[model samples]
Target: MTVRSDDTTLEITRVFDAPPARVFAAWLDLGQFQSWIGPEGIDCEVELLEPRVGGRYRLVMNTPERVIPVSGVFRSIEPCRRLVFTWGWEGDAIRQSLITLTFREIGGKTELTLRQEGLGSVESRDGHVRGWNSALNKLDHYLSGGARR
Candidate 1:
């Protein structure tokens, strides 16, 4: 995994030992998403999921201390290629950000790139880097047939 970040944006690239279609399907599949979409050791709940453009979704991550609720609307979806969405914490609408994910096929594997912007501060961007890296690691493990959380 590689992560790059500036003052208000973050980019991550990772390679997964799965095809692009399977990798892309993970994001739209509520069951698969909840299994690997949070930091390691965190539990996730899918409150709502609508994978089409203009559709809304909600997820809750349960940490040891508290539950963090996140909500989003799908902006675009291109099967096996790309996805774009708006992301924000449930009660913090003003801090909404945009996330774009692109998947490319390489030698039967998937190269996934994620770009996120509109963070309120550098601290927020850094925090997302950590969270996303952990989440991606979990996703890789899941794709490799590891036990689900």
Candidate 2:
């Protein structure tokens, strides 16, 4: 995995031991997505998911001490190739961001690149870096047969 960030944007790249279609499905399928979306020890509940362009999704991440709700609108979807979406915390309008994900097939595996922009600050971008990395690690484990349900 690799990460790059600036004050307003962050990018992370990870290679998964699965095909592009499989990896992409994990994001679009609600049950699959709920299985590996949050950091370790956090449980994610997907409230709504509509996989097409202009669709909307909402999910809540539950930790022992907090409930974090996030919602987004799908801006683009390209099957196993790419996705673009608008993301925001439930009550925070000023911190809205745009996220783009691109998947590349490499030797039967998938390389996923995630880019989030309009973060508003370096601190916010850094927090997302940690959150996304942890989530992606779970995704890796899930795809590798460790956390698959």
Question: lDDT for every model?
Answer: 0.93, 0.92
lDDT of 1 by residue, 28-147 (tens): 998898878888888888889899999999999988899899999999999999999999998888889999999999999999999999998999999999999999999999999988
After best superposition, candidate 2 residue 104: deviation in angstroms?
0.4
Worst lDDT 10-window in candidate 2: 140-149
Show model 2 residue runs off by greater than 4 Å: none
Supply the TM-score for candidate 2. Answer: 0.96
Q: Write the per-residue lDDT of candidate 2 for residues 40-135, one digit (tens) a residue.
A: 778888999999999999999988898999999999999999999998998999989999999999999999999999999888998899999999
Best by TM-score: 1
Q: How far is candidate 1 from the true structure (C-alpha RMSD, Å)?
A: 0.8
- The positional error of residue 30 in candidate 1, measured at the CA in angstroms, is 1.4
**lDDT of predicted model 2:** 0.92
Instruction: State the lDDT at 63 in candidate 1.
Output: 86
RMSD to truth, every model: 0.8, 1.2
How accurate locally is residue 3 in candidate 1, as Cα lDDT from 0 to 100?
83
